[model samples]
Target: MCGKPTARPGRGRPPVYCSRSCQARAYRRRRQPLPAPGSPPAPRPTDVRARQRRRIAEAVWRIAAEQGLDAASMRRIAAEARVSLRVVQYHFDSKHALMVDALRLLHEENERLAQGRIPYDMTEPGALLRAVLDEFLPLDEQRAFALRVFTAYYARSLTDPVLAEVFLAAEQPLERLVADIIGVGEAAGSTAPGIDRVHEADLLVSGAVGLGLDVLHGRRSLADVRTVLEYHLGRIFPDAIPTSRPNPA
Candidate 1:
């Protein structure tokens, strides 16, 4: 009867495994890699190659934002993105290359957004001035964050010549746009007759960069910053503003 199907002692509590190996097998199946206390959860493993490359880039940006550029290493970025060191290296050949790509991506995105917001043509001197100057302010949340990221990258570029080159590449379109505006101002006879166009164009770029940085750092309000920019524009194009009452803001 016992061999046929008799109930064993402690069967009410639980059935004993037939052998220790079975129990060991069950425990092994249950084991998993657990995150340590206070550790962040890991990213999922699906489509890991494409996803981890993007994640590593974003992690580099976040680390740069929080801890500064010196701390944003390829290994650290891979850890933050929760990918293997080989993955980040696979995506980018080296740490400097990774940083260069990341900064280039950021610069390209910023230019795209800024370009999208411009509605004025270079032929329209006054309108072009307003459009170019508009980008120098944090008119909305996206622009505000973009300005922050731009300033961060610009500061990092001081120590990274390759990054500086990438940044200048990104700025070429805007510089050309400025040159076009200066040409319009010259054709319209609005700009000072004696002013050197090339020098003035360079000055305008420097003014835009400096004024934007000042406003970003809270050294001046947007209204005050606009006034300063208009002052520079007026110097460049004395006749651009009509003598009649300007439009209300």
Candidate 2:
């Protein structure tokens, strides 16, 4: 900026600007990479890519939920997502890769949203654990859609090794999280003594999954499932207390 020779600092990166004022000016210029004033903003390459990818994944989820996985061909997914077949092919090498990525994104999104929905005032381990576990059920429209998609993929995974790998990869970690919370509740004297949290986690998680499927199949009512869960909770933690929360449905 000054057009004057400034000696480089010994043994360090060379300066881009001669002085702090020059550095600030350069920063201001770089900060305006998008547009000047109020002209229509330019869509960033990375943002557009992410949006497209998410759109494709969401298309997979919706189709799997409403229709069936059989309907989610590459061409169909591209049409559903409003992208070209070439774009879908470009992002995912094959339909299997696309389905796997969509499942992975679904799990990541479920975990993020579930954690975010936890009550900030829920300091109790039992309460937090219940909150987390409740996410597995098809209680409301959002969770119902999620569980619907999950169940469809799970059924497909039974015969597809690639899909099985994806399911198994994410399953154990979630069980461990539940067991850890149960252990905390036990240590805090809010749960029954001498409980094997790992075993409990396995049974609890498996049972919840089974019940969720039942609910999805219309074999059980939402209230009935909640009642069953509460009964089981009472059996497991006689001293555990309840917290005021929104309807799980």
Candidate 3:
């Protein structure tokens, strides 16, 4: 007999094997017993603090994106994560700490996605420049959310020293990377003659940031931003300018 209990009185034909699926499962189990529950369930794999931290950080990111970073309080984040308030506090001592962690997570994820999109060869300085700068543009939902959070934090950093330090520290590496790429372009003669690579890098980065904000605010579209970037790149690398004529079919 199947393990299921019989239904009372006239419910049905005592429900043999629960259903066709259960009947099949019982037949299979009877043929070969299950592999003895693997050493008392192997310690149950607890959620651990790392997972909690990631969950809390993601909750903060979502809340910050949907309703400004101002709304990402410990209580709100805890509620969003379906965990107790103490859990959030346990992982992050302060709201600023939580925000910083969230920002770091978002930055890491964006960087991974951007790096995946880049090509291995760096021969075309113009193409490399476009690829690098294009990483900052909010052309999709994930990038848009990242841009929003960055802009929000940047605004806050203007008035808060701690956040200002964090923002500047996070930006330094990117500035250096862009400057290096521009230096490569200049060396290859793809960039304009005698151009200040560092200053040009700063200009490109600042422009991308500002343009990203504009796209997020609806003042400019992704296409518009790409057009501007193309024009800007052409100015630095004349050979990179795209033709105006449409390709023939």
* Top candidate, metric lDDT: 2
lDDT of 3 at 35: 51
- Candidate 2 TM-score, C-alpha based: 0.78
Comparing candidate 1 with candidate 3, which one achieves the higher TM-score?
3
**Could you give candidate 3's per-residue lDDT for residues 109-224 as a string of tens digits?**
77788889876356777777887787787766778888877877777788888767777776787777778877777887888776887888898898898887887888988778
Which candidate model has the greater lDDT, 1 or 3? 3
lDDT of 3 at 2: 59
Q: Residue by residue across 53-116, what tens digits does model 2's lDDT show? A: 9999999999999998998998899999998876787667678989999999998898788878
Model 2's number of clashes is 0
Error of 1 at 229 (Å): 0.3
- Cα misplacement distance, residue 139 of candidate 3 (Å): 0.9
TM-score of each: 0.66, 0.78, 0.75
State the lDDT of candidate 1 residue by residue for 69-156, as single tens digits.
7788777898898977765665675788888887877676666787788876766686676678778677666666667666777888
Q: Model-by-model lDDT, in order?
A: 0.71, 0.81, 0.76
Structure candidate 1, residue pairs in collision: none
